[model samples]
Target: MSRIGKKPVALPSGVEAKIDGQTVEVKGPKGVRSFTATDDVTLAVEDGALSVTPRGKSKRARQQWGMTRTMVANLVTGVTDGFKKELEINGVGYRAAMEGKNIKLSLGLSHDVVFQVPDGVTVTAPKNTQLIVEGIDEQQVGQVAANIRAWRKPEPYKGKGIKYVDEYIFRKEGKKK
Candidate 1:
Protein backbone atom coordinates (compact mmCIF):
# COMPACT_ATOMS: atom_id res chain seq x y z
CA MET A 1 0.00 0.00 0.00
CA SER A 2 2.96 2.30 0.48
CA ARG A 3 3.94 3.65 -2.93
CA ILE A 4 7.33 4.91 -1.80
CA GLY A 5 8.16 1.66 -0.05
CA LYS A 6 7.21 -0.41 -3.07
CA LYS A 7 9.89 1.24 -5.22
CA PRO A 8 13.40 -0.02 -4.66
CA VAL A 9 16.31 2.41 -4.23
CA ALA A 10 18.80 2.05 -7.04
CA LEU A 11 22.50 2.04 -6.25
CA PRO A 12 24.52 3.91 -8.77
CA SER A 13 27.94 2.83 -9.93
CA GLY A 14 30.80 3.46 -7.46
CA VAL A 15 28.25 3.44 -4.62
CA GLU A 16 28.18 0.43 -2.31
CA ALA A 17 25.46 -0.61 0.16
CA LYS A 18 25.75 -3.02 3.02
CA ILE A 19 22.99 -4.49 5.13
CA ASP A 20 23.37 -5.89 8.63
CA GLY A 21 20.08 -6.93 10.18
CA GLN A 22 18.05 -3.71 10.54
CA THR A 23 20.90 -1.35 9.75
CA VAL A 24 21.91 -0.17 6.26
CA GLU A 25 25.25 1.42 5.47
CA VAL A 26 26.09 3.17 2.20
CA LYS A 27 29.44 4.40 1.01
CA GLY A 28 30.11 6.62 -1.95
CA PRO A 29 32.65 9.07 -3.30
CA LYS A 30 31.45 11.86 -1.03
CA GLY A 31 31.26 9.93 2.25
CA VAL A 32 29.77 7.06 4.20
CA ARG A 33 26.40 7.01 5.94
CA SER A 34 24.32 4.46 7.80
CA PHE A 35 20.74 4.07 9.01
CA THR A 36 19.03 1.65 11.38
CA ALA A 37 15.41 0.75 10.80
CA THR A 38 12.96 -0.47 13.40
CA ASP A 39 12.11 -4.16 13.70
CA ASP A 40 8.70 -3.45 12.21
CA VAL A 41 10.25 -3.31 8.75
CA THR A 42 12.75 -5.42 6.87
CA LEU A 43 15.73 -4.10 4.88
CA ALA A 44 17.38 -6.01 2.08
CA VAL A 45 19.87 -5.29 -0.70
CA GLU A 46 19.07 -7.00 -3.95
CA ASP A 47 20.19 -6.64 -7.59
CA GLY A 48 22.13 -3.45 -6.97
CA ALA A 49 19.16 -1.94 -5.15
CA LEU A 50 17.82 -1.62 -1.61
CA SER A 51 14.27 -2.49 -0.59
CA VAL A 52 12.13 -2.16 2.50
CA THR A 53 9.14 -4.27 3.43
CA PRO A 54 6.90 -4.40 6.46
CA ARG A 55 7.03 -7.46 8.62
CA GLY A 56 3.26 -7.66 9.16
CA LYS A 57 -0.04 -6.09 8.19
CA SER A 58 -0.21 -3.82 11.24
CA LYS A 59 -0.51 -0.05 10.86
CA ARG A 60 2.81 0.55 12.54
CA ALA A 61 4.49 -1.84 10.18
CA ARG A 62 3.00 -0.10 7.16
CA GLN A 63 4.08 3.31 8.43
CA GLN A 64 7.57 2.11 9.13
CA TRP A 65 7.74 0.53 5.71
CA GLY A 66 7.54 3.85 3.89
CA MET A 67 9.51 5.86 6.41
CA THR A 68 12.30 3.33 6.55
CA ARG A 69 12.56 3.21 2.79
CA THR A 70 12.88 6.99 2.55
CA MET A 71 15.50 7.02 5.27
CA VAL A 72 17.54 4.48 3.37
CA ALA A 73 17.20 6.48 0.19
CA ASN A 74 18.40 9.58 1.99
CA LEU A 75 21.42 7.70 3.22
CA VAL A 76 22.34 6.78 -0.33
CA THR A 77 21.90 10.32 -1.58
CA GLY A 78 23.78 11.76 1.37
CA VAL A 79 26.78 9.58 0.68
CA THR A 80 26.74 10.41 -3.01
CA ASP A 81 25.63 13.95 -3.86
CA GLY A 82 25.38 15.22 -0.26
CA PHE A 83 23.16 18.20 0.59
CA LYS A 84 23.26 21.98 0.58
CA LYS A 85 21.23 24.93 1.95
CA GLU A 86 21.49 28.61 1.03
CA LEU A 87 20.56 31.67 3.09
CA GLU A 88 20.56 35.36 2.30
CA ILE A 89 20.58 38.41 4.58
CA ASN A 90 18.21 41.16 3.51
CA GLY A 91 18.82 44.01 5.98
CA VAL A 92 21.05 46.92 5.05
CA GLY A 93 23.61 46.33 7.76
CA TYR A 94 23.03 42.59 8.04
CA ARG A 95 25.85 40.45 6.65
CA ALA A 96 27.70 37.18 7.18
CA ALA A 97 31.39 36.24 7.14
CA MET A 98 33.29 33.08 7.85
CA GLU A 99 35.68 33.22 10.80
CA GLY A 100 37.81 30.08 10.68
CA LYS A 101 35.49 27.34 11.97
CA ASN A 102 32.72 29.76 13.00
CA ILE A 103 30.48 32.24 11.19
CA LYS A 104 30.20 35.89 12.19
CA LEU A 105 26.81 37.42 11.51
CA SER A 106 25.73 41.01 11.83
CA LEU A 107 21.94 41.00 11.90
CA GLY A 108 21.23 44.55 13.08
CA LEU A 109 21.77 43.36 16.63
CA SER A 110 23.68 45.13 19.36
CA HIS A 111 26.61 42.73 18.93
CA ASP A 112 27.66 40.44 16.11
CA VAL A 113 26.30 36.93 16.46
CA VAL A 114 29.09 34.35 16.37
CA PHE A 115 27.81 30.95 15.28
CA GLN A 116 30.22 28.09 15.89
CA VAL A 117 30.18 25.64 12.98
CA PRO A 118 29.66 22.12 14.14
CA ASP A 119 31.53 19.06 12.87
CA GLY A 120 30.62 17.29 9.63
CA VAL A 121 29.16 20.53 8.18
CA THR A 122 30.74 23.45 6.35
CA VAL A 123 29.49 27.02 6.13
CA THR A 124 30.76 29.53 3.63
CA ALA A 125 29.98 33.13 2.75
CA PRO A 126 30.86 33.95 -0.84
CA LYS A 127 29.12 37.32 -0.53
CA ASN A 128 28.53 39.28 2.61
CA THR A 129 24.79 38.70 2.32
CA GLN A 130 24.87 35.10 1.10
CA LEU A 131 25.50 32.03 3.20
CA ILE A 132 25.98 28.51 1.90
CA VAL A 133 25.69 25.46 4.14
CA GLU A 134 26.95 22.12 2.85
CA GLY A 135 27.40 18.67 4.36
CA ILE A 136 27.06 15.03 3.60
CA ASP A 137 24.35 14.64 6.21
CA GLU A 138 21.05 16.13 5.05
CA GLN A 139 19.73 16.67 8.59
CA GLN A 140 22.84 18.46 9.72
CA VAL A 141 22.91 20.75 6.70
CA GLY A 142 19.22 21.70 7.19
CA GLN A 143 19.61 22.15 10.94
CA VAL A 144 22.62 24.42 10.49
CA ALA A 145 20.79 26.55 7.95
CA ALA A 146 17.75 26.75 10.25
CA ASN A 147 19.89 27.75 13.19
CA ILE A 148 21.45 30.49 11.13
CA ARG A 149 18.07 31.73 9.93
CA ALA A 150 16.61 31.67 13.44
CA TRP A 151 19.00 34.44 14.40
CA ARG A 152 17.08 36.97 12.33
CA LYS A 153 13.81 35.89 10.80
CA PRO A 154 12.45 38.16 8.06
CA GLU A 155 9.83 40.65 9.24
CA PRO A 156 6.46 40.84 7.51
CA TYR A 157 6.47 44.61 7.07
CA LYS A 158 9.99 45.44 5.85
CA GLY A 159 11.23 41.93 5.09
CA LYS A 160 14.51 42.90 6.69
CA GLY A 161 16.28 39.86 8.07
CA ILE A 162 17.89 36.57 7.10
CA LYS A 163 15.99 34.01 5.02
CA TYR A 164 16.41 31.18 2.60
CA VAL A 165 17.25 32.15 -0.94
CA ASP A 166 13.99 30.63 -2.25
CA GLU A 167 11.77 31.66 0.67
CA TYR A 168 9.04 34.25 0.29
CA ILE A 169 7.92 36.57 3.12
CA PHE A 170 4.23 37.48 3.34
CA ARG A 171 4.01 41.22 3.74
CA LYS A 172 1.36 43.04 5.76
CA GLU A 173 -0.14 46.50 5.21
CA GLY A 174 1.19 49.36 7.31
CA LYS A 175 -0.97 51.12 9.95
CA LYS A 176 -3.22 53.86 8.62
CA LYS A 177 -1.81 57.32 8.99
Candidate 2:
Protein backbone atom coordinates (compact mmCIF):
# COMPACT_ATOMS: atom_id res chain seq x y z
CA MET A 1 0.00 0.00 0.00
CA SER A 2 2.88 2.38 0.75
CA ARG A 3 4.69 3.02 -2.50
CA ILE A 4 7.83 4.32 -0.87
CA GLY A 5 7.96 1.47 1.62
CA LYS A 6 7.81 -1.12 -1.14
CA LYS A 7 11.04 0.07 -2.71
CA PRO A 8 14.20 -1.36 -1.22
CA VAL A 9 17.19 0.86 -0.53
CA ALA A 10 20.17 -0.10 -2.61
CA LEU A 11 23.66 -0.23 -1.16
CA PRO A 12 26.07 1.58 -3.37
CA SER A 13 29.66 0.51 -3.86
CA GLY A 14 31.98 1.08 -0.92
CA VAL A 15 29.07 1.13 1.49
CA GLU A 16 28.14 -1.56 4.04
CA ALA A 17 25.01 -2.03 6.12
CA LYS A 18 24.43 -4.14 9.20
CA ILE A 19 21.20 -4.99 10.91
CA ASP A 20 21.23 -5.54 14.66
CA GLY A 21 17.84 -6.31 16.13
CA GLN A 22 15.76 -3.21 15.38
CA THR A 23 18.74 -1.03 14.57
CA VAL A 24 20.30 -0.54 11.16
CA GLU A 25 23.86 0.70 10.88
CA VAL A 26 25.30 1.95 7.61
CA LYS A 27 28.97 2.66 7.05
CA GLY A 28 30.47 4.42 4.08
CA PRO A 29 33.48 6.46 3.06
CA LYS A 30 31.96 9.65 4.47
CA GLY A 31 30.90 8.31 7.86
CA VAL A 32 28.83 5.79 9.79
CA ARG A 33 25.17 6.32 10.72
CA SER A 34 22.60 4.22 12.51
CA PHE A 35 18.80 4.22 12.78
CA THR A 36 16.49 2.17 14.95
CA ALA A 37 13.06 1.25 13.76
CA THR A 38 9.98 0.70 15.89
CA ASP A 39 8.40 -2.70 16.41
CA ASP A 40 5.63 -1.87 14.01
CA VAL A 41 7.98 -2.42 11.11
CA THR A 42 10.43 -5.13 10.18
CA LEU A 43 13.83 -4.61 8.58
CA ALA A 44 15.68 -7.02 6.33
CA VAL A 45 18.29 -7.17 3.63
CA GLU A 46 17.41 -8.96 0.42
CA ASP A 47 19.77 -9.23 -2.58
CA GLY A 48 22.05 -6.47 -1.30
CA ALA A 49 19.19 -4.06 -0.64
CA LEU A 50 17.51 -3.06 2.59
CA SER A 51 13.74 -3.37 2.89
CA VAL A 52 11.07 -2.44 5.42
CA THR A 53 7.67 -4.06 5.79
CA PRO A 54 4.76 -3.61 8.11
CA ARG A 55 4.43 -6.11 10.92
CA GLY A 56 0.65 -6.31 10.74
CA LYS A 57 -2.41 -4.80 9.02
CA SER A 58 -2.79 -2.09 11.62
CA LYS A 59 -2.59 1.60 10.70
CA ARG A 60 0.40 2.24 12.93
CA ALA A 61 2.25 -0.61 11.30
CA ARG A 62 1.58 0.76 7.87
CA GLN A 63 2.70 4.21 8.91
CA GLN A 64 5.92 2.85 10.37
CA TRP A 65 6.58 0.85 7.25
CA GLY A 66 7.02 3.97 5.14
CA MET A 67 8.66 6.06 7.82
CA THR A 68 11.18 3.37 8.70
CA ARG A 69 12.07 2.86 5.07
CA THR A 70 12.80 6.55 4.61
CA MET A 71 14.87 6.63 7.79
CA VAL A 72 17.00 3.79 6.52
CA ALA A 73 17.44 5.54 3.19
CA ASN A 74 18.56 8.70 4.94
CA LEU A 75 21.13 6.74 6.92
CA VAL A 76 22.61 5.36 3.75
CA THR A 77 22.73 8.77 2.12
CA GLY A 78 24.12 10.43 5.22
CA VAL A 79 27.03 8.01 5.53
CA THR A 80 27.78 8.14 1.82
CA ASP A 81 27.31 11.77 0.80
CA GLY A 82 26.74 13.70 4.04
CA PHE A 83 24.83 17.01 4.11
CA LYS A 84 25.56 20.71 3.66
CA LYS A 85 23.80 24.03 4.31
CA GLU A 86 24.84 27.47 3.09
CA LEU A 87 24.00 30.82 4.65
CA GLU A 88 24.42 34.35 3.32
CA ILE A 89 24.69 37.48 5.42
CA ASN A 90 23.19 40.59 3.87
CA GLY A 91 23.66 43.99 5.45
CA VAL A 92 26.03 46.93 5.58
CA GLY A 93 27.78 45.82 8.78
CA TYR A 94 26.65 42.21 9.15
CA ARG A 95 29.42 39.71 8.55
CA ALA A 96 30.64 36.27 9.60
CA ALA A 97 34.12 34.93 10.26
CA MET A 98 35.66 31.73 11.52
CA GLU A 99 37.38 31.98 14.89
CA GLY A 100 39.23 28.71 15.31
CA LYS A 101 36.45 26.24 16.09
CA ASN A 102 33.81 28.91 16.55
CA ILE A 103 31.92 31.31 14.24
CA LYS A 104 31.97 35.05 14.99
CA LEU A 105 28.95 36.89 13.70
CA SER A 106 28.48 40.66 13.64
CA LEU A 107 24.87 41.34 12.80
CA GLY A 108 24.91 45.05 13.65
CA LEU A 109 24.97 44.11 17.30
CA SER A 110 26.99 45.91 19.94
CA HIS A 111 29.03 42.76 20.66
CA ASP A 112 30.08 39.98 18.32
CA VAL A 113 27.97 36.82 18.58
CA VAL A 114 30.21 33.80 19.06
CA PHE A 115 28.71 30.44 18.10
CA GLN A 116 30.64 27.44 19.30
CA VAL A 117 30.96 24.64 16.81
CA PRO A 118 29.64 21.32 18.08
CA ASP A 119 31.15 17.91 17.48
CA GLY A 120 30.27 15.95 14.30
CA VAL A 121 29.57 19.24 12.46
CA THR A 122 31.93 21.67 10.72
CA VAL A 123 31.15 25.36 10.24
CA THR A 124 33.22 27.40 7.86
CA ALA A 125 33.06 30.93 6.58
CA PRO A 126 34.46 31.07 3.08
CA LYS A 127 33.86 34.83 2.91
CA ASN A 128 32.84 37.52 5.33
CA THR A 129 29.24 37.16 4.24
CA GLN A 130 29.10 33.47 3.35
CA LEU A 131 28.86 30.50 5.70
CA ILE A 132 28.87 26.76 5.03
CA VAL A 133 27.65 24.12 7.44
CA GLU A 134 28.62 20.51 6.86
CA GLY A 135 27.85 17.34 8.75
CA ILE A 136 27.02 13.69 8.32
CA ASP A 137 23.65 14.19 9.99
CA GLU A 138 21.10 16.07 7.90
CA GLN A 139 19.08 17.27 10.88
CA GLN A 140 22.10 18.76 12.62
CA VAL A 141 23.22 20.65 9.55
CA GLY A 142 19.75 22.17 9.06
CA GLN A 143 19.39 23.03 12.75
CA VAL A 144 22.73 24.80 12.78
CA ALA A 145 21.77 26.89 9.78
CA ALA A 146 18.44 27.76 11.37
CA ASN A 147 20.10 28.79 14.64
CA ILE A 148 22.47 31.05 12.73
CA ARG A 149 19.61 32.59 10.76
CA ALA A 150 17.57 33.13 13.93
CA TRP A 151 20.25 35.47 15.25
CA ARG A 152 19.44 37.99 12.51
CA LYS A 153 16.49 37.14 10.32
CA PRO A 154 16.18 38.97 7.04
CA GLU A 155 13.98 42.05 7.43
CA PRO A 156 11.18 42.85 4.99
CA TYR A 157 12.15 46.49 4.54
CA LYS A 158 15.95 46.27 4.11
CA GLY A 159 16.42 42.49 3.80
CA LYS A 160 19.46 42.74 6.06
CA GLY A 161 20.19 39.54 7.90
CA ILE A 162 21.40 35.96 7.51
CA LYS A 163 19.45 33.65 5.23
CA TYR A 164 19.80 30.55 3.11
CA VAL A 165 21.58 30.85 -0.20
CA ASP A 166 18.42 30.15 -2.22
CA GLU A 167 16.00 31.96 0.10
CA TYR A 168 14.14 35.06 -1.09
CA ILE A 169 13.04 37.90 1.16
CA PHE A 170 9.81 39.72 0.37
CA ARG A 171 10.42 43.44 0.10
CA LYS A 172 8.14 46.02 1.72
CA GLU A 173 7.58 49.62 0.76
CA GLY A 174 8.70 52.41 3.06
CA LYS A 175 6.29 54.92 4.66
CA LYS A 176 5.46 58.08 2.68
CA LYS A 177 7.17 61.26 3.80
Candidate 3:
Protein backbone atom coordinates (compact mmCIF):
# COMPACT_ATOMS: atom_id res chain seq x y z
CA MET A 1 0.00 0.00 0.00
CA SER A 2 1.29 3.42 -0.90
CA ARG A 3 1.28 5.87 2.00
CA ILE A 4 0.70 9.00 -0.05
CA GLY A 5 -1.76 7.30 -2.35
CA LYS A 6 -4.07 6.45 0.53
CA LYS A 7 -4.67 10.01 1.54
CA PRO A 8 -7.43 11.95 -0.19
CA VAL A 9 -6.15 15.14 -1.80
CA ALA A 10 -7.89 18.05 -0.19
CA LEU A 11 -9.06 20.78 -2.56
CA PRO A 12 -8.04 24.19 -1.41
CA SER A 13 -10.46 27.08 -1.06
CA GLY A 14 -11.74 28.30 -4.46
CA VAL A 15 -10.12 25.23 -6.04
CA GLU A 16 -12.22 22.89 -8.12
CA ALA A 17 -11.71 19.40 -9.49
CA LYS A 18 -13.83 17.84 -12.20
CA ILE A 19 -13.70 14.37 -13.71
CA ASP A 20 -14.83 13.85 -17.26
CA GLY A 21 -14.36 10.21 -18.17
CA GLN A 22 -10.64 9.51 -17.76
CA THR A 23 -9.63 13.16 -17.78
CA VAL A 24 -9.36 15.04 -14.49
CA GLU A 25 -9.25 18.84 -14.49
CA VAL A 26 -8.10 20.99 -11.60
CA LYS A 27 -8.67 24.72 -11.34
CA GLY A 28 -7.42 26.89 -8.53
CA PRO A 29 -6.41 30.41 -7.68
CA LYS A 30 -3.01 29.98 -9.23
CA GLY A 31 -4.04 28.38 -12.50
CA VAL A 32 -5.52 25.27 -14.10
CA ARG A 33 -4.19 21.85 -15.08
CA SER A 34 -5.58 18.51 -16.22
CA PHE A 35 -4.56 14.87 -16.58
CA THR A 36 -6.05 11.69 -17.93
CA ALA A 37 -6.07 8.53 -15.83
CA THR A 38 -5.00 5.37 -17.58
CA ASP A 39 -6.70 1.98 -17.68
CA ASP A 40 -5.11 0.72 -14.49
CA VAL A 41 -5.93 3.96 -12.69
CA THR A 42 -9.25 5.47 -11.73
CA LEU A 43 -10.08 8.92 -10.41
CA ALA A 44 -12.85 10.02 -8.12
CA VAL A 45 -13.91 13.31 -6.59
CA GLU A 46 -16.13 13.79 -3.57
CA ASP A 47 -17.01 16.51 -1.13
CA GLY A 48 -14.44 18.94 -2.53
CA ALA A 49 -11.73 16.27 -2.49
CA LEU A 50 -10.10 13.90 -4.96
CA SER A 51 -8.97 10.28 -4.65
CA VAL A 52 -7.29 7.87 -7.00
CA THR A 53 -7.21 4.09 -6.81
CA PRO A 54 -5.95 1.16 -8.79
CA ARG A 55 -8.14 -1.42 -10.42
CA GLY A 56 -5.78 -4.29 -9.60
CA LYS A 57 -3.10 -5.26 -7.13
CA SER A 58 -0.43 -6.08 -9.70
CA LYS A 59 2.89 -4.25 -9.59
CA ARG A 60 2.37 -2.44 -12.88
CA ALA A 61 -1.14 -1.47 -11.94
CA ARG A 62 0.04 -0.26 -8.56
CA GLN A 63 2.74 1.84 -10.16
CA GLN A 64 0.36 3.37 -12.65
CA TRP A 65 -2.17 4.03 -9.92
CA GLY A 66 0.33 5.67 -7.62
CA MET A 67 1.95 7.76 -10.33
CA THR A 68 -1.33 8.97 -11.76
CA ARG A 69 -2.67 9.81 -8.34
CA THR A 70 0.45 11.69 -7.42
CA MET A 71 0.42 13.57 -10.68
CA VAL A 72 -3.18 14.52 -10.18
CA ALA A 73 -2.51 15.69 -6.65
CA ASN A 74 0.50 17.64 -7.80
CA LEU A 75 -1.57 19.28 -10.50
CA VAL A 76 -4.12 20.37 -7.95
CA THR A 77 -1.50 21.63 -5.54
CA GLY A 78 0.48 23.30 -8.27
CA VAL A 79 -2.54 25.10 -9.58
CA THR A 80 -3.37 26.22 -6.09
CA ASP A 81 0.14 27.18 -5.03
CA GLY A 82 3.35 26.52 -6.98
CA PHE A 83 6.67 24.64 -6.98
CA LYS A 84 10.36 25.48 -6.78
CA LYS A 85 13.72 23.74 -7.09
CA GLU A 86 17.15 24.94 -5.96
CA LEU A 87 20.45 23.94 -7.51
CA GLU A 88 24.04 24.69 -6.56
CA ILE A 89 27.07 24.73 -8.81
CA ASN A 90 30.32 23.39 -7.37
CA GLY A 91 33.85 23.60 -8.70
CA VAL A 92 36.19 26.45 -9.42
CA GLY A 93 35.21 28.61 -12.40
CA TYR A 94 31.88 26.79 -12.55
CA ARG A 95 29.15 29.36 -12.27
CA ALA A 96 25.87 30.51 -13.87
CA ALA A 97 24.57 33.87 -15.03
CA MET A 98 21.30 34.93 -16.57
CA GLU A 99 20.93 36.98 -19.72
CA GLY A 100 17.35 37.99 -20.36
CA LYS A 101 15.32 34.75 -20.70
CA ASN A 102 18.41 32.64 -21.35
CA ILE A 103 20.86 31.41 -18.72
CA LYS A 104 24.55 31.13 -19.50
CA LEU A 105 26.49 28.46 -17.64
CA SER A 106 30.19 27.89 -17.41
CA LEU A 107 31.02 24.39 -16.19
CA GLY A 108 34.74 24.49 -16.95
CA LEU A 109 33.94 23.69 -20.52
CA SER A 110 35.64 25.00 -23.64
CA HIS A 111 32.70 27.39 -24.13
CA ASP A 112 29.72 28.59 -22.15
CA VAL A 113 26.40 26.87 -22.70
CA VAL A 114 23.22 28.88 -23.06
CA PHE A 115 19.90 27.39 -22.02
CA GLN A 116 16.55 29.03 -22.67
CA VAL A 117 14.08 29.21 -19.83
CA PRO A 118 10.49 28.47 -20.78
CA ASP A 119 7.66 30.86 -19.99
CA GLY A 120 6.18 30.77 -16.47
CA VAL A 121 9.49 29.30 -15.27
CA THR A 122 11.77 31.68 -13.45
CA VAL A 123 15.42 31.18 -12.63
CA THR A 124 17.62 33.25 -10.36
CA ALA A 125 21.22 32.97 -9.28
CA PRO A 126 21.96 35.35 -6.43
CA LYS A 127 25.42 33.87 -6.20
CA ASN A 128 27.24 32.58 -9.22
CA THR A 129 27.09 29.05 -7.78
CA GLN A 130 23.58 29.09 -6.36
CA LEU A 131 20.50 28.68 -8.57
CA ILE A 132 16.79 28.91 -7.89
CA VAL A 133 14.11 27.63 -10.27
CA GLU A 134 10.47 28.36 -9.68
CA GLY A 135 7.24 27.54 -11.52
CA ILE A 136 3.67 26.49 -11.11
CA ASP A 137 4.20 23.05 -12.53
CA GLU A 138 6.35 20.80 -10.39
CA GLN A 139 7.42 18.53 -13.23
CA GLN A 140 8.63 21.37 -15.40
CA VAL A 141 10.53 22.98 -12.53
CA GLY A 142 12.20 19.68 -11.68
CA GLN A 143 12.96 18.73 -15.29
CA VAL A 144 14.57 22.07 -16.09
CA ALA A 145 16.65 21.92 -12.94
CA ALA A 146 17.70 18.36 -13.73
CA ASN A 147 18.65 19.30 -17.27
CA ILE A 148 20.82 22.10 -15.95
CA ARG A 149 22.42 19.75 -13.43
CA ALA A 150 23.07 17.18 -16.16
CA TRP A 151 25.42 19.61 -17.85
CA ARG A 152 28.01 18.59 -15.29
CA LYS A 153 27.06 16.11 -12.67
CA PRO A 154 29.12 16.25 -9.49
CA GLU A 155 32.15 14.07 -9.99
CA PRO A 156 33.10 11.54 -7.37
CA TYR A 157 36.74 12.59 -7.27
CA LYS A 158 36.49 16.35 -6.78
CA GLY A 159 32.75 16.48 -6.37
CA LYS A 160 32.69 19.50 -8.64
CA GLY A 161 29.71 20.03 -10.82
CA ILE A 162 26.05 21.07 -10.67
CA LYS A 163 23.90 19.55 -7.96
CA TYR A 164 20.68 20.26 -6.13
CA VAL A 165 20.74 21.99 -2.83
CA ASP A 166 21.11 19.57 0.11
CA GLU A 167 22.06 16.82 -2.33
CA TYR A 168 24.93 14.66 -1.11
CA ILE A 169 27.80 13.78 -3.40
CA PHE A 170 29.18 10.32 -2.65
CA ARG A 171 32.94 10.17 -3.04
CA LYS A 172 34.62 7.10 -4.42
CA GLU A 173 38.16 6.20 -3.41
CA GLY A 174 40.74 6.11 -6.16
CA LYS A 175 41.62 2.68 -7.58
CA LYS A 176 44.51 0.90 -5.95
CA LYS A 177 47.81 1.86 -7.50
TM-score per model over all chains: 0.98, 0.97, 0.85
Predicted candidate 1, C-alpha RMSD: 0.7
Model 1 CA deviation exceeding 4 Å by range: none
lDDT of 3 by residue, 52-148 (tens): 8888898887888778878888998788778989999989899999998899999888999999998878999899999999987998999999999
Ranking by TM-score: 1, 2, 3
Residue 50 in candidate 3, Cα distance off native in Å: 0.9
State the lDDT of candidate 1 residue by residue for 1-177, as single tens digits: 999999999999999999888889899999899988999998888999998999999999999999998998898888889899999899888898888999999988899999999999999899999999999999999999999999999999999998999999999999998
In model 2, which runs have C-alpha deviations exceeding 4 angstroms? none
> How many angstroms is residue 165 displaced in model 2 relative to the true structure, after the best TM-score fit?
0.7
Alpha-carbon deviation at 56 in model 2, angstroms: 0.8
Residue 22 lDDT (model 1): 85
Residues 1-177, candidate 2, lDDT per residue (tens digit)? Answer: 999999999999999999999999999999889998999988998888999989999999999998999888988888888889999999998999888999999988889999988899999888999999999998888998899899999999989999899998999999999
- Per-residue error (Å), model 2, residue 9: 0.8
Residue-level error in angstroms, candidate 1, position 83: 0.6
Candidate RMSDs in order: 0.7, 0.9, 2.6
Clashing pairs in 3: none
TM-score of 2: 0.97
